[model samples]
Target: MITMKEIARRANVSSATVSRVLNNSGYVSDDVRKRIMKIIEETGYIPSEHAKALRTKQSNVIGVILPKLSTETSSRLVNGISEELAKHGYQILLANTNLDPEKEIENLKLLKSKQVDGIILLATNRGQELVSEIQKLSIPFVATGQVIEGVPSVINNNFQAAKDITSHLIEKGHQKIAFIGVDEADWEVGHRRKEGYLAALKENQLRIVDEWIQKGIFSIESGYTSMKKILESGNERPTAVVCVTDRLAIGAMEYLGEIGLSIPNDIALTGMGASDLSKYVVPRLTTIDLLSETTGAEAAKTLLEIIKEGNTSDKKVIDYRLIIRDSI
Candidate 1:
């Protein structure tokens, strides 16, 4: 590797002069600075980020903790975050948990130890253990998805989104509508969405069927299973279904298809997340768009605000829009 000493010798300047030019500190003649910069560009000399971090106490990097990198929502969110952070000369170090809740806390500690200038957590569950660990972080931190009290977060109005989608089904005259959701442990996707669905039903004065409300995991297979259980529960078939996620809705749609059911004609369907699949599916799915990429962008923006300005808003709420497609 060509060292600064070599560049100094080539430029006919002392090492101190080269150092001053690299750091942009003290003084260096404009001609000499330009010459050194040209040499750096020609040689493709990369500065030691580690050395800079130690000297300035800034990593110029942020750590991002996400649940599963494979999901469409997760990938879009990361893209949004990377795009916004890049504008501010910040790079992201990613830690994917593959949906394991424990890994969220572990990555938190790990990122802290790496001396990241800040952290953006793509939170899944708002568990006490995870919140406690987050509270202990010493660096600028922001989260997206689930909310954490007193901690800045970027979130979608899951409850309101759910209520609106359910109400949409109601407006289409779907009084007997089934709901497919995940475990309530996922406060935002599960508990909050269920609450919204229930609220919409109660507002419309529709009877709630216990068996029509099904809980499943975050998988298409789980969605299929939940839909199957709902149908076989010996209750009258619902006119429509509201799934908390597109994957779940897809699975349910598949199941309905296998049973010779035609969408909208047989049963209307609505999903959340507005994944690409939702737009291309047969009959196209009427779904809720969480604007996931915007959520990620806001999370990174909030963290940078905290790191650079020593201040940030408590929360940023990204509005969810009801996308009208043919499925509903």
Candidate 2:
């Protein structure tokens, strides 16, 4: 637990000067700044958040509120945020909201009290209330995944991506395709993906069966249970299933395997995000590549622009690709 005082002693600068260098405050020569940074690094000095908040009146910390850190998507997004923010000399204060709005709101309030410079929200659903609160506080923030009105966000075209995936399945001769996803009326991703699924079906003139469409929480367990229920209902299983995410695809495939079913031969599965694991699955998953890294890079760049320029910009929409692999 090396303190700033130790770093100051090692750098032969006053504690105040060390504090200034750490907070990017008053003029410190570039050479001196470099030396101080080196000393801080060598000393493993942990700066006081309270002191930082007081001197800079900004934490120089970015709040990263994610749905679930365990998921591949959230982890990749966090990695991207880390990579991009590191370049700007900012650190992240991560919070797992567990897809709970109450938790998300609580985390936002805590971050505000801590005086974080800005927040990069990987929020789910409509964040209108949270965004409104941020606006009232005059705090800088940006969202990822789902966008709300008046909030700048970084996300892929979910509707288009889903539409493309569904169309791909249709082109693959999957007329009786099933869509398994989150609840459409609530979750933004669920709604957008469902829109895409419907679009493809309507465009191809394929019948959309109510039984073939299922929605649940975004989890492997939820996917497994929903799929199992779908199977037990004795309704003829479709030739293919379009999962809203790779996690769901993985879970559905696992259950399908256990029931003595084989992929592509019995059923085909398509995932939304082209997660790394998707490539290594028994039958490589055909999916939409969300370009999560590129999205993260762009989000970080946007926030920096807001911080430096003191202005909010339009939402950034990253492009996605339909990746055709063995699963289709």
Candidate 3:
């Protein structure tokens, strides 16, 4: 295997300088960086992770713990985290907890045991306890997509975003607005979005009807099933429906299409998540952009700053927006 020593010799720089460039630690002059890159490319040099860890007391690895990676929402967040970490010569160790508290805690221990320098968590309610545990370990970690008390977080304003989307429907002459989200007992995202929905209606002097609110998993199948249940009940079909996530919105749309319901004419549909898939669907989804990419990037940056500054007392909050489309 091509080694850093050979690259250093070829680049006419010290091995330490070559190592610094490769590891993204310490400073290398522009000339030295260019020469090292050239030598690395020509020699196909690859640094040994073990050796780098010995030098920096860092594994060059970050743990990314998400509820699940099966959905596009988590996938996009991971993409953003990976992109930022790569720029800093860091590798991501992904852990899918399947929204299980035990699994998430287990993964946290494993990542710490492996000596990862930092972690980014897309957390649920159970995260508050896990984060409290992680804090005691003095490990650098950031929560993305959801917030927990007493920990730094990178979150979109889910409450405000949902409120804005709901208010828009109300302004468009829709008196009865339905909300579909996951069980609030599990995910914080669902809870906050639901809060926003209720807040908007309450502020507008509209009755908050329990019959109009639905909860299930944040999946297309769940959305479809829940929406079907709502339709079957014959309990005042809502003029508009707001979903907690884009996947749910898409699923609800599919059901609406099957039942010969015209979107925005018979019933309007909208959801959270600015995922690309939302654009391709017919009567393209009207949704909110969570700025998930920025959230991920900022999480990495904040974690790195915490690691460098040796401080964990700060938190970061990102904003969200409503992206109107043909759906509403």
Best by TM-score: 1
Q: Model 2 scores what on Cα lDDT?
A: 0.84
lDDT of 2 by residue, 138-215 (tens): 678888888767888888899999998898888878898888989764445888888889999999999888887888
The numbered model that scores best in lDDT is 1
| Cα-based lDDT at residue 105, candidate 1 | 94
| Ten residues in sequence with the least summed lDDT for candidate 2 | 129-138
Residue-wise lDDT of candidate 1 within 1-328, one digit each (tens)?
A: 9888888988999988887887778889899999999998888887788877886688899999989888999999999999999998899999999889999999999999999999998888888898889889978999898888888989999999999999989988888999999989888999999999999999999999999999998899998999999999985899999999999999999999999989989899989999999989998999999998899898888888899898858878899889999997
**Which should have the higher TM-score, number 1 or number 3?**
1
Q: Count the backbone clashes (under 3 Å) in each candidate.
A: 0, 0, 0
Which lDDT tens digits does candidate 3 get at residues 1-328? 7777788788888888888898778988898899889888888777788888888898989999988888777787888888988998789999999978788788888888888999888877645567667677568888876666777788777788889999999999988888898878654577888998999999999877676788878778988887787787675788899999888988999899999999989999998888787899999999998887888888888888888896665567778877889998
lDDT by candidate, in order shown: 0.91, 0.84, 0.84
Task: Look at candidate 3 and give me any clashing residue pairs.
Answer: none
Candidate 1 residue runs with Cα over 4 Å from true position: 9-20, 23-29
Clashing pairs in 1: none
By TM-score: ranked, best first: 1, 3, 2
